[model samples]
Target: MISGAHVILYSQDAEADRAFIRDVLAFPGVDAGGGWLIFKLPPAEVAVHPTDGPPQHEFFLMCDDLDTQLGEFRAQGVEVTRPVSEQRWGKLTAIRLPSGAELPLYEPLHPIAHSL
Candidate 1:
């Protein structure tokens, strides 16, 4: 019987990170204890992909304004990434995590039939 769940991002400056969420993404959080702020996020779905080399989980969030989003992240001193081009399955960009991991940003590209 699985119930509601959420992911936690541990930060050196919890307050500042919380502020970023509040100001940028606008996801307010509850103070659990010791000044930990927890946000309510949508249920995440796992995307099937093959991998190796100490697997890390990746998440995809839909955004219409990726350019603006990249700008914001850059302004915050977060290193943003640019993938070379679109893939057969999807279009993507990336941003670096505080832990030096690349987080992929993707948007779907439909075949000719869907565009019509």
Candidate 2:
């Protein structure tokens, strides 16, 4: 049975990035002893993009309102690397993690498929 999905982010500073996700983003998770943490993501959707080079994957956290979410993140001292830009699909931006990795965020302009 296909249950849920688990996504892993490779970090230069795993502990700091983990703390960012746990404390800053406030995603509830369970520590798997020795301070290893696994987080529960919100409803997720996947899409495959064609490339000429080797295939790669990307991740984004969906939100209802980009401005409000960005404001909240900014209030928590998170750095916003990209300003919101409108696309045919959504309003998008990126936030910098503690390890200096950028995590993209967006509010969908199209119908969501998370329930379907």
Clashes of each: 0, 0
Could you tell me every candidate's TM-score relative to the true structure?
A: 0.60, 0.95
Deviation in Å, model 1, residue 2 alpha carbon: 1.4
Q: List, residue by residue over 2-79, the lDDT tens digit for candidate 1.
A: 776566565565566576666656776688898767887643444556787777765665454566777777787867
- List runs of model 2 lying over 4 Å from the truth: none
lDDT of 1: 0.62
- How big is the positional error of residue 90 in model 1, measured in Å on the Cα after superposition? 2.7
* lDDT per residue as tens, model 2, 1-116: 98989899999999999999999888999999999999988888888778999988889999999999999999999999998999999999999999999999999999999979
The top-ranked prediction according to TM-score is 2
- The residue pairs that clash in candidate 1, if any, are none
C-alpha RMSD values across all candidates: 5.3, 1.0
Instruction: Give the Cα lDDT of each candidate.
Output: 0.62, 0.94
For residue 43, model 1's alpha carbon misses the true position, in angstroms, by: 4.8
Error of 1 at 93 (Å): 2.1
Best by lDDT: 2
